[model samples]
Target: MRVLSRFKASTIRRWLLAVGAAAVDPAGVLVCAVLLWLGTAGLCIAMLLVSREDAYHQAIQVGRNLTLVLERDIVRSVELYDLSLRAVAEGAANPSVMSLPKELRNQVLFERPTTARYLGPITVYGPDGTVQACSIETSIRRTHRPDVRWFITQAEKTDAGLYVSAPYASRTAGGKIVLALGRQITSPDGKFAGVVVGRLSIDYFRELLDGLSVGKQGGMAVIETNGILLTRLPYNRNDVGKDFSHSPVFVRFMKDGAGSFVGTATIDGVRRLYVYRHIHGLPFVVGVAPALSEVYAGWRWRASWVALLMALFTVALAAGAWSLMSELRRRQVARAQLQRMARRDALTGLENRGTFDEVSRREFLRAKRNGTPLSLLFIDIDNFKAYNDHYGHQAGDYVIKRVASRIASRVFRPGDHVARYGGEEFVVVLPETDAGSAVLIAEEIRLAIYELDIKHVKSQYGRVTISIGAASSGEPDTVDEAALIKAADMATYDAKSTGRNRVCWHTASNGLNADEHIKNTEPGDQAHP
Candidate 1:
């Protein structure tokens, strides 16, 4: 009985020690659990937001593409109609066509079979808006003369290339809705004669729009520059020629000339993404709208799957914390090692471009906060490509490794950073350094590489050398990383251009002047024999 009692006490003590090591206070465990739940919830919310943004952008792109397609189609159709009008106008002016019999004259002026599909009877109107000739065999004296906007526009604005009128009831086509495209006719002496007009069937546009892939609730529309609805898909006869000036989409279109937006349709109350564009050289705006639900349907499915996987992950993490506490420490160490490897270059063992960017941003923020100066140096090996071609890539790789090592050794300050910008190019970041100090360090780096004495027959120096460009930011709060990099790169190009094996500092005043290049010997330093 005593032995059993001792065993029970030992088991209890081990349990107490495990619980104490895991967390001193029970509230700590509870807090950790609550934090984990919150993290999972936050992750889900972030994913949903990102998904929504992506969907919105995709819808905008689709709207833009659709608008372009519609614009091209409309422009092409109008051009086709204009071609026929010009033909008729020129034919009417010819003495031979006017002398021909009425039947042949009609056939010659208006290709009946071709024009019948898209246009009503081709008519020639006098300056008084009286019909003078028609494609059909009808006496103009008996036909009622109609005074319309197209005839008036053609007579008043003779120089206007093409005149498109508002949609109206067509008398010749049995009261069908149609619009007229008129071209002015002038005598050979440039005198205004009359106008040749072609009535375009609105059904042609309706049919064309119906063939598009816009879903059931989606629509296409044509609006005059004055915010009048000329025509629309789904073809509501009453809505034709209605004033669309009050619509949000129309207001934005008028303001910006061309753009996209999301809004609920006034006609159907369906939410949609609308893209509008002004037709080039025309007084019309074309809009294509697609339902938002259809655009984001795939994204919604993906979000659902993401939510499920995240929930599973949260549960798994909880289980792991309870059962594998000791293994957690080992995994953490491994994760840290992996992260370090990801940020380091494999061959040179220096920080990579990604690491350089991250560290530079952090240092830039620190400098800005502390009101200190920062400098950057861009380094390139001279004639390295030629060396690679002559000595083989292996030797080229060796040179790069050696150069990277030398640069890493020279930048010894804790705040200083070095990175392999790319093949044979290195970047060094120095904190709290002024232009003068940065230039001195660049010269030191140039000398260090010169002393290595790697052979390169293609090089002018007969040994591998480097060119460095240094740029310093006097006020960290004012300058960003991109500006510093651009300045340094330009200075490096200048170093290569003026001479190899030199250091150059960027100066805004003189544009990399000669004074910024460092000579071999400085003040108080002995010249080499």
Candidate 2:
């Protein structure tokens, strides 16, 4: 089992290494890593935004559900109270109520069996707005009618069997804010008899809202269709019956009829996600709102962790890419040094014979294709064998290096090549040069070497000198590289045979007798056919 586990681990490690090598190109690794980091960061940001939006939606949904529940609760309570008012109005309209005693009449019309806690005593008003009957003994003696807003509304709304009034201060209930539900009572002849009004304490709604699960900064409110605030959670006495017609939430609610929004509450100036619902059968709206900060608390924590991880990932990738690029650059520099060593002559620091051959062949082919003249110069050290015998091999090597340097310096031009061809011999190739120009350049090189004045007692010149044989091919396509080399070699041999330390050129007009042509032209004169 141990052996199998070790084998699997090694295989996995090797596979990972192979994948890394294939995927990471040093030149583009940094770019790819940066793009990857940006993409990841963008994805994280997108996720954070999505999460925030989802949280907002969820908060709105919670508020909407609470709003719906409150709406139903308030509507059901008002409808129940309206039924009580209808019963009182019908009873008060009966002729039997006039015959009954005042106390019994009040009992029959105002006092009824009920289970509501916040319901006030029912009051009956005459058509002239005078108190006819009251459930409370103290209110019965009062001469003036209640003079509440519901009395006017009920009188005006003859067709409406029931009417709910906006929140107002109740005189009978000691000036406490309350809501009224009233029904219009009519005579047998269809004349307006009076109104029966039932006042409900605002504390009922305030206590109901207090029992709800709104967050620490959350709130709830009930408003009439005319934009009058009826009741609010964390109830402030001044807020009751206040106008909210200009508020943004109320305006939108009125326009959309029913919807959700995010806005600052007009009551407390707290920013919240608000959900509102229009009561189905009542002239009122209910809203539940929770603070925005509480909704996004969890998302912020998760986003922080995501951002931290993305930062660490970006840093690691950048560091790896830098190290890889640095290693690749070092390897490239080492390979270039090796290539230079392979193609260059060690002593003279010029091209070796192999590199020379390759370059010359390429140049020759290019010149042939273009119909340009190409020239070759084969240079031999004068009395090099005798000089080596006298000065020893070390001195011969020094002389060879000095001569190669001089030749290279003289033929410095674009497309010109200089090489150490063999023992005691150097070669130069000049492209776009004719026989006359080639001979002129050869004389210059010969003179430059002769001027070096290296002591050579056994030589005829008494100094280190060179013998140059130059050959030019104007029609390079018809003349091959070997033919051109052979022509230059034969000219070099003739220069050596005649006298060392001189320049000679192979010319077509000379008919292979270069010596005859050399006799007519002066030492520094241009070589002609």
Candidate 3:
């Protein structure tokens, strides 16, 4: 009886362990399933958006291609018309083709293509828009109404050249649908010859479209401004003669002449994606359509793969987020360090040259606007090269940095900027200070550099010192920043030329404020005698 009770207890413990394991496994699977589902959903949405963008891009590129082809054709047609018009004008001037009266002139002018490559009919018109002659058997005597408009319109306009007329109803002998191309002719002395007009059949453009493929299951159409279907793909007999004025595509093309537009349309009883573009320079709009199924054929399958990858990535990302949080913290610290470095000069801790220039200019303008005196001092180290020679280049750098620190300490106001202009040269801009005060500051800087007592064994001079020039300008309205700098620079040169390690001031007074020399002198500071 004791053994049976022990066996029952063991059986109960085994059953409890099995139940716990089953519960934990299902809970883990449930959490994973949730993450997978969310990731898949997000990937699907992203893929959908990307696919839409791709479709729009493809549509625009195709539209631009169509526009380019049409422009090329238009240019070629104009060139051909130009050549034909010149030929016809030459014939009209020839005495051999000139004997017949104007009515029969067209018939007399008739001649077979001796060149064997002529593509279309060539006709000549008088200045009055009457058909003067033609190579074809057309009745030139009959009032050529279509010829009349193009000739009169182009001849009346002075700047007329080879131009395409808007698609208009043709009244010429062969009254098929047509557009007229004409060129204005003038003699070498600028006398006007009549226009030579050529009729280009629209069917040639249809052949161009037929050769191009937009997408699988895609087709193209060309439409007139009035919504007439001039051509359609697959060479449909019914579409060739029909007008699509009632179509939405035509309505929108008439409204906006450029930019991509998308819509749904029916082709062969199936809904398709339509991308339409308007040709602003032409009299037509071209549109292409691809069946929706073909355009989105692989979209769903690709989306599924993208979703699966995103699911796995999300699981990996979550694990990485927890494990690599320290790296994220490290990146944050690095970004802050970079930002600090961006604003500081790595060589000398003083504000960078760019910062000094900006601040000095602002203060200079402020002092000038208020009619307060502003002064600038340009300082250069004397025989810096000798110092660099005596001690290596690195020692020279230390001397420059030490001198900069000395000058930086002498400036009292926050508005004063001490900047290293270039190697061995420095600048200090003093707002609200006149030439006298600027001279005092320059003397102080000169003394400070001299006090450094940096030994240069290779130098002729015993100790290194700086030569400084001070210029002050009080004429706010008459002075510009460049003039201020020039005055300071000239004073510096004067200081250096007379003697180094000295402060020189430029006085603006002209012995006579002569205009020619006044132009040479700076505001408030006269040239030193």
Leading candidate by lDDT: 2
Question: What is the per-residue lDDT of model 3 for residues 325-356, given as tens digits with 9 covering 90 to 100?
Answer: 54645655776566545544555556566766
lDDT of 2 by residue, 221-283 (tens): 888889998888767878889999898889988876678888998777889888888888788
Off by over 4 Å in 2: 1-27, 96-114, 130-143, 213-219, 233-235, 267-271, 292-302, 338-349, 352-354, 379-406, 420-426, 446-467, 475-478, 489-502, 508-529
Using Cα atoms with residue i matched to residue i, what is each candidate's TM-score against the true structure? 0.52, 0.77, 0.42
Which pairs in model 2 have colliding backbones?
A: none
For candidate 1, list the clashing residue pairs, or say none: none
Against the unseen true structure, what C-alpha lDDT does each candidate score?
0.78, 0.80, 0.66
| Runs in model 3 lying further than 4 Å from the true structure | 1-25, 86-119, 127-129, 137-176, 184-194, 215-217, 237-247, 254-257, 264-281, 300-529
Clashing pairs in 3: 507-525, 507-526, 508-525, 508-526, 509-526
RMSD of each: 34.4, 8.1, 35.8
By TM-score, the best candidate is 2
Higher-scoring candidate on lDDT, 2 or 3: 2
Order of the predicted models by lDDT, top scorer first: 2, 1, 3
Candidate 3: C-alpha lDDT = 0.66
Q: Cα miss at 441, model 3 (Å)?
A: 99
- Candidate 1 lDDT, tens digit per residue, 56-153? 88777777887788789888888877887888888876768767987887778887323547666667765566666776655233443445667767
Residue 165 of model 1 has an lDDT of 84
